[model samples]
Target: MVCVANTTGRAVRMPRPGGPGGRLLLAGHTGEDPAPEGPDGTVAIAPHSCSWWAI
Candidate 1:
């Protein structure tokens, strides 16, 4: 899971989880791209949640 602490008083936008195709890391397909956290897509307001897996 990814934890983001925004000390700055501003709303932050993050990329949609898993990017396009919703790719995820697999045991055998380790070479396959495990979608990463990036600065691009949606916005998660406090009290809500943004989720990701770190592989």
Candidate 2:
């Protein structure tokens, strides 16, 4: 799990595999595209939580 801070500096849990998706969510709705994924393919975030994993 990756620990990230928001605009308010609140640390939140995120997935290392799907970091891009999480990063976008933390962007405060900035309409920015997420980071590129590695060769492993983009990760998917699970509902009810910010956690994610490779499918």
Which candidate leads in lDDT? Answer: 1
List where candidate 2 sits over 4 angstroms from the true fold: 1-28, 43-55
Worst 10 residues of 2 by lDDT: 46-55
Give the distance in Å from residue 25's predicted Cα in candidate 1 to where it truly belongs: 19
Clashing pairs in 1: 14-41, 15-41
lDDT of each: 0.37, 0.35
User: Which portions of model 1 show Cα errors greater than 4 Å?
Assistant: 17-40, 45-55
lDDT of 2 at 27: 22
How well does each candidate superpose onto the true structure, as a TM-score? 0.30, 0.22
